[model samples]
Target: MKRLKEDNLKHFFAEETLKKYSVVFIIILAVMLICELFIFNFKWVNSAFDKKVDAEMTLSGINESGTDLKFTSDSATIEYKNLNEELKYLYFKPGSNKGGVADITLSAVDEANSSYFSAPSRTVLTDVKSSEYIRLRFSGEVKDFKITVNGMNGKTISKDNIGLNVRVPLMFSWIRFLLLSLTLMLLYVLRPKSFVYNYKTDLSKNWQRIVTLALVAIQIITFWNMIHWNTGVLEWHKSYEHHRQYYSLIDAIKEAHLYLDFEPSSALKNMDNPYDFRERYAQNVAFKWDHAYYDGKYYVYFGAAPAILLYLPYNLITGNDLPNYIAVFIFGIMIMIGILLLLWEIIKKWFRNTPFALYLLLSVVFGAAACLAYAVQKPDFYLVPSLGAIMFGLFGLAFWLSAERKNEDGTTSLISWRLAVGSACVAIIAGCRPQLLIVTVFGIILFWNSVFKERTLFSKKSLKQTVAVCLPFVIVGAAVMWYNYARFGSPFDFGANYNLTTNDMTKRGFVWGRTGLGIFTYLLQPFNMDAVFPFIHDFNAATVYQGLTLTEMLMGGVLWLYPILVIGLYGAFKKNSFSDRRSYRFVYFSVIFAVILAILDAQMAGLLTRYFTDFVWIAFIGTIITAFAYYEMLRDNEHSRRKFAGIILTFSVITLVLCFLSIFAHTEDSIMKANPTLYFTVQHLIAFWM
Candidate 1:
């Protein structure tokens, strides 16, 4: 009986082992399939497919009087239909010249049988001279004639140019699908068992609940602020009319629509300058209160779908005057919330025993500076989407890192669900900005590595579950793509209007060139840029100057956690254990990705540190790792740990003092030049700091 019990136990253990490692096999297979299909283009079959549609139009005329007729060909075509009256009208492309004339020869057999207008030929005066439409007149007598219209041949309109590349060989697409499926399957089969065990931990459960509530509150607050503050207050409204000095909100909306919808034509004269089109579209639009909602084209629009949806109800309730300040406020609040959540997740996962109070204070000050700087200066809410995405990624990393390990048993272990929620947030981030798709891909890879490479969680079922977790992001991403296609004709196209208002093409070069310069200037200017309190406004012959200090850049003050973050990176590189290294690798990848993005988007005027805020979060992660390293080092020496802690505190205080001093210097200068009262208040603050 004892021998039989041992055999049963062994069988149970074997089954459990299979379940644990199945996801790893699944992922490996999936990866192999992907590599073979898309990258190698392994072909299984060859076939040809073709599809075509033909359209025809016919026009007939029956008249008794012999009439001199004219036929004009406008770029725009109209579908033909039969009319019973002698007089008929058909819409055609607007003519090129103001009063262009076309002469049509009308021939018909005596007033008896059907008068044939067989393909009436006329020299249609083209409107190649002006941007404005030219009306063409065509006069004809009643006669029987048939006009056959052929296929259209003209410049394609923006709407008609939808380039859906469905023509990629079906075999290739099938192979890709197959490979993706297989890789996903393998990933599932070979995934680590620890993931499930860690997920079962109470730490994971509690944090998940806490983070969810925080996220919900943040989302609600963001929505409220976007609708109530930005959209409600800063929106342009009509208060004056006779003097034509004040612009109407309706005009602003119209201008936005025109700017978004306008298409340039080769045949239109005096339309050579694209800026003219933009300028004409923006004319008569005025600022509301002290803030202008429109960027001469679109309203200072926040492009995230959730935010937009939230604002819709409010817009309906209040009518269309959406204040820009609402967006600004929401953006600010969201940034703060994201940063707090990130810091909280990091501390909870890695530094739970550390002083939460100190961490909170440091997080608030640092996050506020970074977020507020971006908000007040740039005022572009479109960036919120990207920011939201990075926040989600951070959440995912936190969860993956915080999962608990399980010993040899059939029971489950626990992992941080706060981290899972964070991963889920990546989808929301991607929705806000499509470019973050790169980050999303990197995130998926990191997650896969965590589950398979580190924890050895593998099974078909686990792989499917992983894909399911990722589905929301994919669906949202596809929706964004479709939206882009609908608006821009191509999913990848950002539309033709790539102009920046302040930075002219000559000074900044083309957009890409300017962005390159911006990146270069950002890293280089820290050494030389002047500092001013409240405001740092100086413009060189070409560049705008803002004051930033070197010490702040190096030590990061309340942001001192950045230096510590490097320690985490060091752990990632040196530690052989999956748990110790995976999070660091993920953060490292994120930082690199963020840097690349910044470089790609270098067209902005300055290389503001705010642009790299996501990277700063990665630095925070590094700091956590560094703190862990410090803890480990002090494990045998209590006195040293105490000394190290004191040193860190001192360093933080000194950094803060220096930052304040820098701010004070700038405030004093500004007050001397502009406002004495404000200057005195700043001076008093400086004195207090001193």
Candidate 2:
């Protein structure tokens, strides 16, 4: 009773201290948020439009000058005339126009001295709108006509006097900023507050509270920074306009009219009418909003609906652009929560000590290297779902590995729920990225095998149960397959049409997985790849070298220590003395199998480092479990145990440092140019290689 009272008192004081600091942190964060609003000028609508214009201009440039541009037989030859002023417009016979204006320079060649015209000049034009055909009455004789035809047969026309204007939309600029501010204000008000202080009396409760607060903070911050809150402001208004433009499609649908019914004569048989054909044929066009609309085929493309769901009424009220960043942010928070849950489960099943739990948590959260890797590598979004699926599989295997399940009396178990949710998460992952279906299948098979070890192909009951458990996933998988088939005419076709046209087979084949060289570069010599180490070029190393700088290697190493621990646990399984050895072994094998499957899938075309991030995480978990299993081995020998612990700790620290350094060193040149100081600080502290 006395001890309990003392512990309670200690906890109370700690809570008080935490409360005091948390208050300060909240105030500071609030002030910072306000200051950020002012410091970073938000231009919602104009910026969005500006980006669109820039994209259009860039695309126009590429179409005009890129080597890939192909001219058809029907292309017309246009004439260029020298203008005395800084700006000049060239008139063309209007038709359903597809091309934009491009600047062309002309120079006269002299045969006498073989010299070109001096002062080779330049002219710039904007708003080069094109239309079908224009009938013009000419009164004067045109002179010095130089025709530079871009398409098949060259044809040219000359004109002298033309009009030009520099028109800019000033209203959009201010309206966008205003809308952005309103959205930010809404987000700020609804942001999570001092929930931690409410549950400070109990340590366990306090931990949960802290984690929740942390997740909320991460979500808000990520949404604000990563998604760019200002971008949403522009989207909100644009969405309405998009809906207005697509009203015709809706009307046609309501009238039970097919695209062919409305425009039988307008069927696009040539590339010239592709844009018009696409606009007419595509259905479910609620709003032709930028990337936000569910791409007519039911495949979630824009990720706007989910983002809007995050804030609900507040977002609707403020008319904020639905930023997909919210989804990414939430995904990241879920990952952190999932990790914490896994860690808690590990501690509960192994140490069962509060101090040990605290230590592990602190080490994970505050370890310099680990923190750096986590900050830079934005792996949480996808990693969490993958890890969650693995965790479910592991827990299911644990049920099968139970020493004497008959001895225990329980009709219902959490394992069933874990299996269902885990399988669903895996299905979701597969749906999001079809390639991951291979990993999901591997996990399901591993789980089944773990349950029915030597019983082979004849175990009907086990097979039935497994099938029943996986039915939901099968349905989801089939749905996804059907979706792919609908989109590309073949279930397995991954939209290779773009690749076919580009004719960049290197990118289409195995090079850099999707394009350049091949998966060999990443697998045979991961260290040499730009992803692992920016400077290293060697590819002949026999084993994985710490190609990353010391700091980066250390950080990444610490986070990945879980895989090593799993390996150690597997080795200990041979001892046959530990009571839970078999369970640990099962987990170890399952994780290893999953990793192998992930690696194999990644070795094919279209693999990336991020695609294999989940494997790294699962490997880490296995390592931790192995460490827990072998804890008693060290305790039995004090001197040896101390040495082992020191060595492991040192190695973890070193690896963590290296990981952090590797990620930190790669600066985002694009971001830095926009906001140099902020970019530099964040890049050094948290930005990941991706």
lDDT values for all models? 0.39, 0.36
**TM-score result, candidate 1:** 0.48
Best by lDDT: 1
Candidate RMSDs in order: 29.4, 18.4
Q: lDDT tens digits, residues 551-614, model 1?
A: 1122122223223333444544554422445445545564455455656444422343445454
- The clash count for each model shown is 84, 46
Q: Model 2 compared with the native: what TM-score?
A: 0.45
- Residue 51 of model 2: what lDDT? 18
Point to the candidate with the largest TM-score.
1
**Predicted candidate 2 versus true structure: per-residue lDDT over 1-690, tens digit per residue:** 999999986775455365645554566556545443443322222133321110011122113433233223243223223322221122332112322232333332322213323222221212222111111112122222222323222222222112121221222223334444554443332222312212212226666567546744654464335434123222332344422222232333335531211221222222232223234345322222221111122112211112223433434466443332343444444555455455555445444322342334323532222122432334223233333343333333333222112225532122444455555655655444444344454344434434555342225544644554576578867765665565545665544222211122223232222221212322223343343322222222132322211111211121232223334435434545344544355455645544454445433322333334434544445555554444445555656644544444545544544453444333321222333333333332221211
